[model samples]
Target: MLLWNPDMNWIRNPFPPAVLALILAGCSVAPVYERPQADVPAAFKEAKGDAAAAGNADWKPAEPADGIARGPWWHVFGDATLDGLEERAMAANQDLQAAAARLAQSRALQQDARAGLFPRVDAGVGPTRQRPSPASQGRPDDGPSQASTLWRAQLSVSYEADLFGRVASSVNAAEADAERSEALFESVRLALQGDVAQAYFLVRELDAVQALYRRTVALREQALKLAQRRFEEGDIAELDVARARAELATARSESLGTARARASAEHALAILLGAAPADFTLAEMPLVRSAPPVPALLPSALLERRPDIAAAERAMAAANARIGMARAAFFPRLDITAGLGTEASQFDNLARWSSRTFLFGPLVGTMLTLPIFDGGRRDAALDLARARYEEDVAAYRQTVLTAFREVEDNLANLRILAQQAAAQDEAVAASLRASQLSQTQYREGSVSYLEVIDADRNVLQQQRAAMQMDGERARSTVALIRALGGGWQAPEPVASASPRR
Candidate 1:
């Protein structure tokens, strides 16, 4: 019969001690994480001007129902082709796929870190045959040693006590890292969407310019024919015909260049959609000159809206947690290992109660692993963590600054470009009128053909410039949407019930 000592019972069961240690170690040493302060302005600098102010007053704050769908901001442009391309890019873009994979990896690492908080249990069974040396046993070597067979089955459990919050800190760091990765993934997705939209706009713009040049080429040919007829009739000099031919050739060259630009833009769009250039083609669609109005959000909203800022903030939190982990390294660590097993001389007798010899107990140990003599490894690690924290803080600030700058830049582009487009429209109208008057005068023999050629060239250039400006406005609108975080919002946290006492 085995006599049980009540006092030793606790020693044989180390789980109670481990639980108490874990409860004590629940106190975290990591600093409380607070988002670093950014210098934000009350209003966008460009949004304060008279033109912007008047425009803002005329444009009501766009409600979700009145404006583009928040989930797909590209819908605001009301372009079906753009919507289709964005969908395809999201489905097949390699960069987005890689970012998603990284996010998954970070989540897996978080799970691995979290596992440290729980006990690890393992079991094994094996049969072993061993021979002891007679010399080691202090016996005279006379014959071959006899082999003995031992069959054993064992189960073991081990758990770190987390005496200094190392496990908790590690888990926190991993969670922060995972959050950072998630933010980065969102950032990449938003960037891809923006790229597809911008590229699509650019291709359409090129198509419009190409059409304009084609028309200019026809007009120049007509003017050349008129010059030739006038010269043949001896009503104009051969210099006029030569000049007309030169203008026609120039127009044709421009038309060819425009076609090349359109092809290049289409190729770029195809790549954005993860397709080969040769396999992809876009129909000639007219440029959408009207940009959807964007609601002006306050500067503070940028902090919550920007994904890069969120990532930087999470990185800082992770770095701070690592510092706590490094500091915990200076303290004592507790590990508890317990095992239960049965050993027998033969496999047949291993399961017999009489033949079984059992051993079960805990081996509780505490290790004070202070790096006292290391070549400043601990100090260097701690310093590195702190430095990384500082770097993240600076990066967070910089991201916020950049976010603000992008919004301001796009806002200024839209505002000033609107005024420029108006002026350009007037220039185009005036040039058209001048070209018509010059042509009539040259036909009436009241002016030279050179004047008519100059007027026609101005009209073509002005019209092309106007079309290019429209494209710019559309592209800027997309940029502003991207700068505003592509309408992505942080998910609301679910509230958990209070724990029962």
Candidate 2:
């Protein structure tokens, strides 16, 4: 206690000041938080019954999706190229990196708010000079204003009392905001990975089409050569030879179109990996692998799976906390400031024990401030916070519904596509046989060149349709994986409404 004066009295702090602050803080005015519930089913509808019989043949049975890692999900397709592309996108995509930066900012803000929970201390050492007015110095009006310099070396501490939970509410809001940012970052990452995989699969599907067309071109060339020979030998008419040439030209043109499509898909993939279209090239490889079974999770588990849902829920919580902060504005605010230092006119005397000074009191003696009237500003803020919370609730519910729709949509696609694939396989086989029979008849002069050409076209079309079905199955598989949050793992229990002040 360096404070000493004949007119001043000394007092001892009887209890820990921190404990007193807590006792006086009482309770927060913020409404108790409750996690808004969304309509959820016992199980995914697409995973059972008539809708699932054909589709889920390629799908794994429903399982508890909690605590499972969904990463490396692309491996299920058994495509190394897809896995590689996903890794590249994860590491280099600008959008994902930008989301990570935003998460960092949110965490920093949380730390800033957390600071409000504890006292702030500062130490300063400096010399300050000032000139006093003659009147202020109690001198005659004509007296000279003399300049004086003082040296000070001191430590100060300040803390705001959470009297009505204002500090607590601010901290809560910031924490929720940080949590939301983290979930959003995960959401961005999952979307990027899915996009890369989807694009890769599309490129491979195009490769299959390209290969199919090229084979047809070679066959058509052989047919044209045979027709020319028959025309020279006077076994077939000139019209037959002309038709064969036309078929060959059509095959060549269709092959060129497939090539163009492949190039466009490849370029899109390159951009997803954070490269210019010209700088990236994927090797031509056909999509031959079947899409594997993705775990069909129960609907309740979905609440913990989707990052977007998590983020939306967190937004609601932050808004709820803001309501409390707004309500606290109508209550008294208390700030405690204290300092211990030495001051002297001479720099050399600043360190002397006799020159010591101390103070412990509210800044400017403003011990408390309860809002009286501010043109209804506090009331408006409270209303605004409540409105925002309601808005977040609506958004959160919409997100849940959208998630459900995505899962159901992909599941239906996979089911119907599976059934279609089986039928297309049979059609392709029958067409190939028909085309072979037509070619033999044409060679024997038992059928016109028109019949052979029609049969060949049917075979080509059916084979292409089968290939397209395979691509659709693969695409639907990837889409379902994304809807399930890109992995089987479950998140931590969500923050729920509590009565804690």
Candidate 3:
């Protein structure tokens, strides 16, 4: 157990000189730290007007459902495969593992810094054989030498007297850096999760598109066969057969392209999940039709929820603490050292108390060092610290601005895409109807095969467009959630009772 003694006077102390010195070395000169201010908006710009009103009914301001775990925000998509992939990524992702290791390294460095506040004790023992020259007796120029074994054992203790807060300031700076590292780890984790989700969704979207193309290829092949039969039966021209075959080839080429895209997306996801591309595979799964409702939150909450913002804030604190450490270099430093040990020339008498010799009588002393000249080293360090603080402040503000922009951008995307999806749905239905009518009229000899071909192509294009829009809406929804900081929340403060007057 350690005791705290605020009083430094050693005159009346019953303890030894070493104890007194240790107790009085706690004074520091570092200034108190305060968080810097950042400019923030009352609300998001795009959160107003139609964007907010349009999705107001669908947006839920309450906490997410229990079935969808909060910290793993990807669970809200309700896809078991996605949830599994996220879990695997969190456990094995190399980038996240590296970030965690960095955090641990920072914590170890902080521990080393905190050790400066305590005394360091070390002990050592050594036995040596030495010969002494006898010429010092002045009896003869050449004389015999006497050999003896000497055993020496000693213990030493040292503590910095933090009289100017250099050690304390350094510790504070290290602690702040450790905290910054922790936030950075969390930032990396969030980014990894987001990347995995985005890549997975892309793969699923490509699957949907590829499936559409496959169906189109099959239908066009059938149409080609029908045109070939009609041309052989003298009912249609060779031009009709050629057009159908060309459309069929185009559909097949598109299907192959979509397959390539899906494969690329899958490979990207595999990398994010920390698996080899050749060894990893994701089964075909379609994206969920409806996007999970996003909870409404105040703009100020973003500052607290985003890990990157927290990291920036911690960086500013570290820089601020470093400034104090730099300032401390301009003042005097005090160190206290003490040693207690025994030395003996005879091995047989080494264990005996009478044979032990005290080197410096408890060996207690204080050292004060003042740098009268340093060629502006301290001043440069102070300037650098202040400059870093300013840089971190700028970065923090910029991060906040970028976060707001992302939220607004995704909100606009989701809103406009919703409208476009509705209109495209209607267009697809109309094209399908037109294709059916043209096919029937062609069979009844009321129109040329050209009308049927054009109608079929229009139907396929409209359907593909509708599917693409769905994929966009899903991707935008994921982006919006990521921008909202992925379900992070500040801890609730506990209420305390009022003190009596």
Output the number of the lDDT-best candidate: 2
Off by over 4 Å in 3: 1-27, 49-70, 128-149, 355-366, 444-447, 488-501
Q: After superposition, how far is residue 482 of candidate 1 from its true place, in Å?
A: 0.7
For residues 1-501, could you state the per-residue lDDT of candidate 2 as single tens digits? 356455643335523677477547567888889999899987777786343343433243434332233446676676777888888897778887788889888889999999999999999989989998899879998899979998998889998888778889999999999888888877887788888888888899999999999899999999889889989999889999899999999999999999999999999999899999999999989989585766667778787778889889999999999999999999877777888899999989987889898777754656556679899999999999999999999999999999999999888888788778889999999999999999898778899999999999999999998988998888888888889887543233421211011
Lowest lDDT sum, 10 consecutive residues, model 3, at 492-501
Deviation in Å, model 1, residue 10 alpha carbon:
5.4
Q: Which candidate order results from sorting by TM-score in descending order?
A: 2, 1, 3
Per-residue accuracy of model 3 over 301-349 as CA lDDT, tens digit each: 7777676777788888888888888888888776666555556786666
My TM-score estimates for the predictions, one after another, are: 0.88, 0.90, 0.85
Say which candidate scores most in TM-score.
2
132-214, model 1: which lDDT tens digit per residue? 88876777886457889888877778787677788989999999998888778778877999999889988888888888888
Off by over 4 Å in 1: 1-26, 49-70, 138-145, 354-375, 488-501
Candidate 1, 70: how far from true, in Å?
A: 5.0
Q: Is candidate 1 or candidate 3 better by TM-score?
A: 1
lDDT of each: 0.78, 0.82, 0.76
Candidate 3 lDDT = 0.76
Model 2: residues >4 Å from true position, as ranges? 1-25, 49-69, 362-365, 489-501
